[model samples]
Target: MTQSATRSGAPERVGRFELLVPIGTGGMATVYLARTRLIADTYRYAALKILHQKLAADDGAGLADLVAEAKLASAIRHPNVVPVLSVEEDEPWVALVMEYIEGETISGLIRAARAKGERIPQPIVGAMIADVLAGLHAAHEATDGGKRLDLVHRDVSPQNVIVGLDGRSRLTDFGIAKIDRTNATATGLVKGKTGYMAPEQIAGLKLTRAVDIWASAVVTWELLAGERLFHGEPMPTMLRIVNEIPARLRTIEPSIPESVDEAVAQALAHDPSKRPATADAFRKILVDAWGNLADPAEVGRYVQALSGEKLDRRRAQTEEILDLRARMTTVTRHAEASARDTSSSKKAPGDLPTRLESGPTTAPGETGFASTGSLRRPGRTRALGLGIAALGVVAFGVWMVTRSGANVAASPTTPAREASSSEAASRIVVFSSKRPIVAVRVAGRTVESPPALTLGVPVPTGAHEAEVVAADGERASVSVPADASQVLVPLEPATSAIEPSASAGAAASARPTGRAPGRLQPPAKATAAPKDPGLAPPPY
Candidate 1:
């Protein structure tokens, strides 16, 4: 596999995914453009959302939520919903691998149109929202073992809806979704955007599928009206959602048909009972009101027209990664075959070592290498031949390293001896840390490190203080041993004060990065009931 460099120089490999570039970052995770090689000459592109190391280390809750999102999203198999392919947990990193959608988000489309002093066409908005409602209907009615899931997508803002270049809209990011099987959000702790939340939801009342309907309607309203349905700071937004009625779509955008305006108004009613009972019901009303919907092909063309340049750049980057992967695979295969052939030729006749009985090859979804059992043959000749073959392979490895212009130590696995003051500065010191490091500073130089399982930083052999920085902003320093070639530094766990909620607000307010499929908001404090009922602390 190949590795890419982030700005922090983190090695971008999580499980089998080779992260190409980061598409989006939120409070809990960063979504990357990644791919997995199924076999030689075959690969599958995916959006790999990796939980931040600090968040994953904070507690088990973050990991559990990631698992829940995978399970919930995977259960609903529909065209309008993005699919989760797999979930991977590799120590400090937990990731959700999903089918990569190549297109603009609805939020992005809105921003582009606004920049040009335009609005999304009424028919296009109707068609896109219809598809989103279809996806939500599937999620709401999904089942497990023939039992109803009672799923509610708690977060369904424009940022969470992606319109692929194929002209299809797909709903995604079930991070804050509620399902009957999992108590994802506790009582009193509100989750989701303040503006899109239903009156009942903001009041911390019981939530149902109707909440998604309210959010969907808000998105539809913004698309047609070219303005936020509820715009203000968090507290005020919540107040407006709970205490005020929204202006009709036709009132703001005169071109909007009266029927479409009425349908959206019904869905945005203050009381759940007053709104459409289900997403399907609301979608039906919208379709009937609009009468004619934009074709998928037509929607795709519009998306391309607005985002053609950016899409082309992303497409070029993907091609470069695929090409690099192919080249690396060819080189690795050639090296392995060369080593095997050279070792085999050095063995004498009838002196072959014990043959390993082959077992099942690495299966799909399995990580790492396969294991085999060796059938031992009782003979000193076999042992001697094996020793010779091992020496030959080692020699070949050294030769290869030398040919690549790298210094070869006496032993491949051992570090080189520290160089004396009189000796040339050919000796190297390797620095490692217990935690994933972001960067290392030694000998008046700072080197960006990877977020890999094990970190190793090499510098010219010397006595110096090395400072290391972890992803969570934890820092530690170690004094390098003058005569040693390796040093291990330990960093204490992150302080409890580094709350995930601290950055949640900023993440929520920031524009959608790339094709991220979710809106991450701060965990809302459970508001005191009108009757003053006490509640537990908000879940960070």
Candidate 2:
């Protein structure tokens, strides 16, 4: 288990979702890092946002709002808009499950920068804002069935925009979104953050996509100014937004281009019609002003540099989770075995489920097998069959062991790796080979590579004899302690000489100075530690 696992006990289940860790919490909902199985035994990560207990107890009205948010966001399938998978109805608790974005919020990034007595690069900020606008435009132009959704994201604060580690900016949380077809909000009630709210929104006037346009402009202003664009109490802030603009905005960043300032000021125009006609227009203006700076990879680099420690801790915690899953699998197998043994002694024929009661119908006068009724006897024939099946299973297991070249230790020698505490359960050695690695023997267990390169293979921390054999009979052996995070084995064919890439060799040989940065070494070059365990934050 990772360190966090010991500190906070992992929740076994939250509805049908397996809660891995608590990622973030807000006034309306608490988000959890979770995983759920999809089709074909595949699993996907998701952010499960469940309404707070206090809110859920209010006759389910709050739950309805969550459902509405999911519905609204699900309809708009843009890359920049965070995707909502479903609204799960777990009894007594409803959750809005969204595509798990493995990255920090823009707000979190700003806070981290402040802590370091620095600011995010201006170009990066401009790029992120552009991405947000692109997503907002998609939502505005979304269609429901054959009709336009006419969706307006009323809440477009920094908290709502998630900058993923993959360097993409996604707009999330459409809980307060205004739709033409539905009226979830009352006519005169105000919504959205006070400082970022538009004049029309503050007055509870009829809203269009321009409100989002206005909020987006305010966010860009804050990013550049390094402070809130509007201040004071809520009422005063609303009045300021309604009646005035940031007169000192031009003076806030002397280095900012004049054209950029003029564009932002236009978007913040008090009159909605005077603002850019659509989010796309505003985005175009900003992109031109910023000029050739939107690289998702840059955002990815900044996030990794800022959150290296937090991410490492998460990775360590993930190891514990993987170990737990392995244990659960073992338990399930044992239970199945016990059930099969019990069924072998069952006396009642009716105990079988409805599907097993009948056999394939025989063609007219074609008798390849006995009738279903004739096979009902559970005495000598059944016992004999069970014994034969058990023997066959054992023989298969033996064959598998032999085929994988797993041999019991002839004599107890020195261990290969140093043993770690419970934390080691999550620590694994990742391997990437040029050729197909057919079998990997680690800690007395043989792991068969599944068509793809085996990234994370758990080996106990201590002296361990690890061996890798390729499909073409090429083999490589390594005696390494599990204490090291990763090990690279290049199983080249015996006849041909294999040359390793310089970068990969350097990465493998590089000694640890401190906690490494989040960027992984190129896969072709070196075998780096897994950035994310199978259920971790982001792939990159």
Task: Highest lDDT: give the candidate number.
Answer: 1
Cα lDDT tens digits for candidate 1, 1-540: 111211122234678877665555565676777777888957778898877555666667778788989999999999999999999766556789998988888988997788678988888888899999999999999999999889899899998998987899999999889944443344344778777889988877788999999999999999998999998898888888888889998878888889999999999998899999999999999999999999999999989887664454445334433433444345445546655655554545676565655545665457564544435444544456666665565456544532321211121212345434543352344343333344455664444322311223345644666666554555666666455443444543333212111111232233222331221112222211121123221111
Assess the local accuracy of residue 233 in candidate 2 as a C-alpha lDDT between 0 and 100.
90
Candidate closest to the true structure, highest TM-score: 1
Q: Worst ten-residue run, lDDT, model 1?
A: 1-10
Clashes (candidate 2): 12
lDDT of 2: 0.65
lDDT of 2 by residue, 1-540 (tens): 001101111134566777655566665676766787776667777888877655777667677778788888989999999999887775665788898887778887887788788878888998899899999999999988879988889889988899887899999999878844443333334767788888888877888999999999988988888887887898878887778766546798788778889999999888889999999999999888878675889888988888654555454444444543454455445545755874666556555433334556666568755464433444544656766665566445433432332221111122334435642353345444434344466666554432223333555656565666554445667554434333335443234322222121233233232332322111222333333434444331
Tell me the spans in candidate 2 whose CA falls farther than 4 Å from its real position: 1-11, 38-42, 179-189, 321-540
Question: For candidate 1, what is the lDDT?
Answer: 0.66
lDDT of model 1 at position 466: 69
